[model samples]
Structure formats: C-alpha cells, structure tokens
Target: MTDTGWTTERMPDMTEKTVVVTGANSGLGYEVTRALARKGATVVMACRRTNHAKTVKGRILTEVPDATLDVRELDLADRESIRSFAENFEADYDNLHVLCNNAGVMAIPRRETEDGYEMQFGVNHLGHFALTGLLFDRLLETPGETRVVTQSSGVHERGDINFEDLHGEQEYDKWDAYAQSKLANVLFAYELDRRLDEAGIDNVLSLACHPGYASTNLQRRGPEQEGSRIRLWMMRLANAVFAQSAERGALPMLYAATGEDVMGGEYVGPGGLMNMRGLPEIQPSSDRSYDEQMADRLWEISSDLTGVTYDFAQAKAADDD
Candidate 1:
C-alpha cells in the first residue's frame, strides 16, 4: 500500500497485538496509544507516573470503551526504573508486538539523569537504547512481525554528535543538546535495523520517525523548568503560529509502527511543507544520521554506559529452541 497520505485510519488491524508506548499519558504518545488501542491492540501505557497514566487510560477507555489498557511505571531518567519496568513487563506479557520509544525530554537546561548522563540525551536516547536492549530478546522471540519505533525530531538536521563532550559537561546549549539526542535516535534506529539484518532476523524491525512541528507539552517544559516566563511565552507563540496538533504530529510514528509497506531503517516524517506538518511519509534524515562509524561508536558507548548489551545470538538461539 502506498504511504502517500497515510494516517491512523490506514493502520492495519492490531488484534491480539500488544504495544508498549512510553510517555503514553500525553502528546504524541497519547495519540499513538489511543489509536492503537482503538484498533484492537492491548496497549501498555508506560509513563513515569503510574497515577497519571491510569488517569489517561481512563480517558482513552471513555472514548473507546473496548480499548484494553495497562498502566505501568517507566521512568526513563533512571536506570533502575527502566530495569524494573522491563522485568515486570517480561513476567506479565508473553508477546510484545510494538515498542514505541516515544517518551523524551526536550530543550531543558543542563541536568543529569540518575546515572549522571545529560538529561536530554539520557532520557531521549540512552534510556530508550537501554530499554530496547533489555527487551530485545522478547521482541525476537515474539511470533510474527514486531517493531521498535523510535521517535526523533526535525531539528536533528542541526545536530552534530560531540564525542569529545557527549554529555555537555564542557559546554551546554539546550537546543543543541536536544538536537544531538534526536540525531542519536535516528542513528540508533538505523543501526539496529542493520544489525538485525546482518543477524538474519526478519521478525523484528527497527524504524525511526519524527513528529514534524507539533504543539505539545514538550515545548513548555524547558521554560517551565527554568521559570522563564518570556521564553515560555515565545514558545507558546511559536506553537500557536507554526505547530500542528499532537494528534496530527503522531501520524508518522503510528504509520511507522503499523504501516504494512514501511521498511526497517526508513525514517518516517511529515510529507508537507518543509516537512513541518502533514501526512506521514518515508523521508530522509540528516546526512550525519547515516554515518555507520558514528552509529557503531554510539552503540558501543551506550552499551557500556547503560550496561545493557543486546545479545542477538542469544535471542536467535532462544527462538530456534
């Protein structure tokens, strides 16, 4: 099927599928969860706050009375939390059809995660990297096709991974850090697809997508944290003038997660003016995002920092058994 004007309406039937959506309580993540649940998928709403997720789940159920929803705690800023969530999820669910790495921190001031990594990169890239590795075996062992859809951003075009100071310890620019983390998202997704291909693994696909310019709570976060009223006002103005709805922005990720014609390693985004807002379509990411050497380096460093190594061989062996 052509992805010319793909939207959530074009999504395939998701009966019997189980999806995990991080940050499912709001914004693009919320839209994705609601859409998938409406399509007959049992959605695990992975949020840092369980109470809030439960509230969101209730809201979704009100709209789609038959939607199956599960609220689970997943704090991407903390390694311990990530590990706990993965362990709990593995014990409870036998199948994981789609993992939407949709949770992230945007242009926040320099901060550190529980593991002392930069806040934006930690939560946005490294955290998801670790989670995917932790759940790799489950994805591989699951029957039929499974997907790991990572959320990136359009600002990745301006990113340049600074290996010398990846954490921004030397210097920090909020927007630059955010861009770096986003570029890392695309790199990780493409690298994962290549690795899966090399291992002869066809059941699991890794794809990356961006939400163009969506008006979400993400924009208000940085200024809110810093108590910058003027900055917040500017962001609000920008959103009002240039951004699309979170529901519209979420189309790319939903398409990446469910589109039958989508291929692994493809970067899905808006097909509209300047790629800011429109229907979902396969698009090209930044040239730097395709650097094999950089991706490999990031993967290796991420495994070391997070201590979550992906054992594709073990997963393959388990599948064979």
Candidate 2:
C-alpha cells in the first residue's frame, strides 16, 4: 500500500484497539479522538482540565452513541501529573495500540512549568517525551504493531534548538520558543524511530505529522492567557480566513495513526500548496529537522531534565524472550 490517494475512509477496522490522545479536549486532538472512537477503538482523552475533557467526551458520545471513550486528566505542564496519568493508565489497561502526542501550547508569553522549565518547550516537547517513555512498555508489549504519533508544525522550519537556552533563561521571544518546541517534536519523533529500529523493535512504529494551518484554539490560548483581546481577535480572524477546519487539519495525524502505508520515521502532512490544506500524504520537513547529532543531544537533555529514559534494550530483551 502506498500513501497515494489515502483517506480516513481507507482506515482499517480498529475494534478492540486502544488509543491515548493528549490534549484531546479540543482542536485537532478532539477530531482525532472522535474519528478513532467512531472506528471502534477504545479512546482515552488525556487532558489537563477534567471538566473540559468531560464536555468533549459528552459531545463525542452524542455523535457516536456507541463510542468507547475515557477522559483522563493529564496536565503536560507538570511532570507529576504526567507520571500519575501513565501509572493509572497502565494499571487499568492491559494493552495500548496508539499513543498520540498531540497536545501543545503555542506562542504564549514567557512562563515556567511546575518543574521550572520554559512553558512552551516543557509542555510541548519534554512533557510528551516523559509520557511516552513512561508508557513505552505497554506499547511494546501490546498484541499488534503499535504507533507513537507526534505532532509537529510548519513553523518548525524556522526553529533551532539553543542548547544553552533550552529553557529561554537568557532571553525569550514567544514565537521563537514555540518554534523550537515544534522542532524538538520533529527531532524527537525521528530519533525515536531510529532508536526503535536500532533496538530491533519492529512492532512499534514512530511517526510525525503536522496540521497545515489548522483552525484551532491553540492560537487563542496564548493571547487569552496574556489577556490580550486584540491578539486573540487577530488570531481568530486569521484562522477564519486562512486556516482549514480542525477535522481536515487532523487528517495527517489520523493517517499516521491508521494508514498501513505509513512507516516509522516518515513525516506526514497536507498535500496542498506549501502543505497548507489538502489530503494527508508523505511530506518533507525542514532540512535541519533531520540532523541526527542534534536529535541525539536533545534526547539526552530531555531524559535528564524529565528524569525519564527509554530503556530500549530492556524492551528488546522482553521481545526476544
């Protein structure tokens, strides 16, 4: 099977499979959760706000009467919350087929997470890194081929990892921080795939995708948090005029999750002009995103910062036995 002419309609049956999507309360995350639930996958909506997650879950149930959904609190801005969510999930579920690292904070003003890391980099990149590491065993031990789909953005092209300023301590530009986080996401996904292959793990696939200019609340939150009405309004206007709907924006992720044609280490995005809006297909990202040395360094720093490291050797041994 090739990525050519792929659509959600071609997604195979997902009955009995389990998927976890972070930031599943709204935007692209919500759309992905809904589609997976409709396809008979047991979907867990991992989010920070319990109340908001409940509302989204209710809406999904209304749309798909039989949708199997669970709303779990997962505040990516806090490391403790990430650990707790992963522990609870593993205790309750025997297998996990998909782990979608979809939640993120956009170009918000300078802030710090509960652990004191820069907000954008902490929440968008390190947060997901920890969560994936914590639950990697479950994914590897699952019945069939499992996937880890990390979401990146087009803005990553302009991103560069400032090792000295990973936390933006010396200086901070909101957009620059956000771009770095997105680049980290892409680098992490690709490195993970390479590591998985090196460990001789064939059943687990890691991929990355971007929603080309998707209309989502990600743009509003930064301004709303800063209490800038003008910024919020501008974002809304831009979304209305230039962005595609959340459902369409979520296609690349959905395809990465369910498309048999997709492979580990591949990047998927909209097939339209400049990858802004169209069907999902295999796409190329920024040249810098493919830097193996940078990815290795980032992974090391992430493990040290988050105190969560992936032991692929152990995973491989388990598979061997």
Instruction: Give the clash count for each candidate.
Output: 0, 0
Residue-level lDDT for 83 in candidate 2: 98
- Predicted model with the maximum lDDT: 2
Candidate 2 steric clashes: 0
Measured by TM-score, how close is model 2 to the native structure? 0.98
Write one digit per residue (lDDT tens) for candidate 2, span 256-276.
Answer: 999987899999999886788
Provide the TM-score for each candidate, comma-separated: 0.98, 0.98
lDDT per residue for candidate 1 within 1-321, as digits (tens), equals 234778777899998999999999999999999999989999999999889889888999999999999999999999999999999999999999999999999999899999999999999999999999999878987889999999999999999899999999999999999999999999999999999888778899999999999999999999999999999999999999999999999999999999999999999998887899989889889999999999999999999999999887767777667
lDDT scores of the candidates, listed in order: 0.94, 0.94
